[model samples]
Target: MALLFEYLPLILFFVVYKAVDIFWATGVLIIAAIVQLVYYKVSTGKIETRHWIFAGIAVVLGGMTLAFHDEQFIQWKVSIIYALLGLSILFGKLLFKTNLVEKALMGLFSSVQKEQEVEINIPNAIFNQLLVLWVFLFLSIAVLNLYVAFNYSLDTWVNFKVFGLMGITFIAIVFTMFKVYKFLPEEQ
Candidate 1:
């Protein structure tokens, strides 16, 4: 799946860390991210903003970890990426009056509209609510990552990054689904 492809780098990093060492894992992660990005662009014929951001963080911070032999750089990558994501959502909504959630959903809506033979428009309320939810989600994840990184040992932080964070994100997705379900445009 596309989601799995997006996470290939992280998954590989976790595996490599278990098999070898953080230094080796960091190198693997950097290579994996670059490969993922190339494959994604080739397959999709388009590169998403998030893809660029992910690759950038992986290269810059992961490179630092590799070059300087400091695990801190790698630890900060998630927080930085999350912060940027949160800011992008807020920036889009506030400055451009753009609802990224709505924009993202337009493709699905188009398919539904074609099937139902009706027009569908997501209300502004839904957009605003989703935007706020996403901003909170991103910022919260960033803070949580930092909290774990600062407070825990390297092993513990790596565990948190790989498993704990994914669990939390899964929960957030479920919660967001429940919140947004009511706002879905119905077929007329």
Candidate 2:
């Protein structure tokens, strides 16, 4: 089931007209994502702030794409969102004591027994810094995607859509894992 969810976007693009314009198959995937978000809210009875912000971005940027009738604008939308998210994470964590990523990521660690014990002790600043890093990682993905979509071909974009994002994400994961592993705290 998780595998299905993961590959669903790439599968849709290929099963349809293959991310081609006029059809704007990516738009359909976005729409489906929106619907899933709505259903999640109904079922869970909680709406995360980050998801709301993401929806706002999608609407505004997607509307911009429609209003201007420019594919480039639309193509660039994901990058803008990624860059903005990255910047926000950087600022929120480094300058302020906020952590959008930590807050948005509650579900992942919610089940851990030590989560509650360590939650309060965790440095908000570091979480914010981590958010910044994660967001920048996402931004890298957006930029790479744009490069392939424009300079190469839709097929290349589709291929990246399948593998490129994962590759970049894997890089982040490995970096973080190595950092954590190498920097084990000295127990007092």
Candidate 3:
């Protein structure tokens, strides 16, 4: 549900882009982001930090795209959001002594374990490694987005943004799941 919500705007953007033009897609994306944010607030009773970050980028950058009738600002939105995610994880680890990846993963892990009546603990060293891996991944995604945006046509970049980027991310998550499986307790 949350995952669907997270990608709702991008999915809508792709649909609108294919149906109409970049300007219309940008406008729809902005609206989708706002609707997603509002849905989150109503459903969860509060907005997550990432939600705010995404919505802010969408509105500001998409607004610029709409106002100026240039698509470049909206094109930069993905790279900026990815960089911000990487930086926020880095800052949280360095300044707050909190590993956001570990924090989020552990919460999900604990819930699953509770349901299965199993327990598995990941060492801090491994969590640190995971955090570093995520930071690098985020930064790499940002760089990749920028490279595609600059070197390719808008239509090509939009395709890369929706399909190519999603393929990379899906592969990344699958790889991470394999790594995580190593630490799971075997069922008796």
Candidate 4:
């Protein structure tokens, strides 16, 4: 599925974190991002600046992790990415004239019935909140990983990574849907 590639870094990280070293996982993430960049450029004929920035940061941070020989560096990767994304969304709302998340997600944030009208503030608020949520989620995951890694086997962490994150995400999706449905315009 298309989502496979979209989340390939995560998949590679989870699998390789157990089987291989963190350095190998970092390499795979960098390589995948590189391949994706060229693929998107060639196929879509336009490069997303955001992706390029993210890939570049990952490469630099990954290289640091390998160079300094510290696994903690690799773990900070998600935290930094989450913070950056949260800041970006905030930036879009406060500084930029456009809503970055809304522009990027296009119609994904809008309801089926509201083809009639979308209040810009609503999308902006939702996206800003989502960004903040990501920050908290990533930080919590990082802390949980630390606690689990120190206390138990890596296998437990891996299992938690897959099932726990997925469960939380599913719950968030359901909550968002409930909110959207509640706010949808009534049928005429």
- lDDT of each prediction vs. the true structure? 0.85, 0.62, 0.89, 0.65
Query: What's model 2's overall lDDT?
Result: 0.62
Cα TM-score of candidate 3? 0.93
- Candidate 3 per-residue lDDT over residues 19-61, each given as its tens digit: 9999999999999989988898888899988889889999999
Models sorted by TM-score, best on top:
3, 1, 4, 2
**Consecutive 10-residue window with the lowest summed lDDT within model 3:** 172-181
TM-score of every candidate relative to the true structure:
0.89, 0.66, 0.93, 0.68
What lDDT is obtained when candidate 1 is compared to the true structure?
A: 0.85
Better of 2 and 3 by TM-score: 3
Cα lDDT tens digits for candidate 2, 1-188: 75575446446645553536523654654575576568558878886676676556656655666667655554665677677777777777668866767665454444542534443234555555567679768777677767877998756765676677667777877775453442333332
Give the range of the ten consecutive residues with the poorest summed lDDT in model 2. Answer: 179-188
Which of the numbered candidates is closest to the native, going by highest lDDT? 3
The local lDDT score (0 to 100) that residue 33 gets in candidate 4 is: 78
**Residue 94 alpha-carbon offset, candidate 2, angstroms:** 3.2
The collision pairs in model 2 are: 93-128
The best candidate by TM-score is 3
Query: Whole-model lDDT for model 3 versus the true structure?
Result: 0.89
CA RMSD per model (angstroms): 2.1, 4.8, 1.5, 4.4
* Regions more than 4 Å wrong, model 1: 185-188
What local lDDT does model 3 show for residue 9?
93
